[model samples]
Target: MDDLFARQDVIKRLLNESRRWAFVGLGDNPEREVHTQARLLQRRGKTIVPVHPSAATVLGEKGYAALADVPGQIDVVGVYRRAEHAGAVVDEAIAAGAGAVWLPLDVIDEAAARRAQEAGLDVVMNRCPAVEWALRR
Candidate 1:
């Protein structure tokens, strides 16, 4: 893991500043961590946009089939896919012009992280938004 992955300042800024988050792979499954985290973010006053192939609305937010399909600016792109599939999602996030890309705990992709960083997006890999927010409080 890159040292930047664990930077407290970066985590704090991402959690405290970003308002809109696009959750890729966020399906309608309540049991999934993505669903739980998205709900947590919503409770924190952040807008959550669901991005999935099914495009099924989750948590009452409209869903887009792809990141590019989203109509407005996205502050963060939260990736919930497996590590193997995370790189592609990061690429999409970069292309979508997100302010940051977050790969939750257990999802590690250093190469993709570098790519996102190189594209000027804050990269937070192997971290959980809920946990980060809890620590700040």
Candidate 2:
């Protein structure tokens, strides 16, 4: 737990340097955190790719059903699913050749985070990219 939080620099780099971000579980619902964060990332100059089972367009951007379905390189996979479901997303992120995996607040899975880190991905768990960006500002 301590080690994950201690890697704040990694998280910052992931959020700052990564160009394309695939947001799993993101949908058209503006009320959801995914939608909010996606907009925030876009505002910060990060390309946001919305990934949802429904394949619904969000925030004027086309959506994909899964990570592998995304056409281009995904530098970061922002996971918004439940804690238990995060492992599968992390695995998919690795398979998709993402540079990092970000599990937002309340999506805690130590094993999944470790797996992502072991796979050479910068992992950020239980943190909000938008909040981090604000703090860095």
Candidate 3:
């Protein structure tokens, strides 16, 4: 596995610089981690684009059925799906020309992370953006 995940500089940069975060698998359920994290990002002034099959509007932002459906640049692609499904989302994020791919918390897919990195996108896996932000304080 690549050492990219261990790089604090990269994590800090992604968390600090990236503005628009497209959260794949984000649903309308407020109890879900995706919803909470997306809200946190929004509270921090980052634009959150929810991407799900239903394309339900989440956190007051219009949702898209897929990453491709999201118009304009995506600064970060946050994968809230299971590890097995993450690669496909990462691929879509790459296709959408995102600046980075973030696999939250327990979600881990080394191959997908590698693929995103190979595609010139920053990758952060097995991490929570909210926690990362808290740690910076």
14-93 per-residue lDDT for model 1 (tens digits) = 89899999999998999999999999999989999999999999999999999999988999999999999999999999
lDDT of 3 by residue, 11-118 (tens): 899888889999998989999989999999999999999999999999999999999999999999999999889889899999999999999887889988889989
lDDT for every model? 0.93, 0.88, 0.91
Global local distance difference test of model 3: 0.91
Best by lDDT: 1
**Candidate 2 structure quality by residue, lDDT tens digits, 1-137:** 76664377887788778888899999988999888999999988888899999999988889999998999789889999999999999999999999888889889989988888898988888898878888787
Q: Please provide TM-scores, in order, for all candidate models, with all chains considered together.
A: 0.97, 0.95, 0.96
TM-score, structure 3 vs. true: 0.96
Clashing pairs in 2: none
What local lDDT score does residue 107 receive in model 1, on the 0 to 100 scale? Answer: 93
Q: Candidate 1: where is the Cα deviation over 4 Å?
A: none
Most accurate candidate by TM-score: 1
Q: Return the lDDT, model 3, position 40.
A: 93
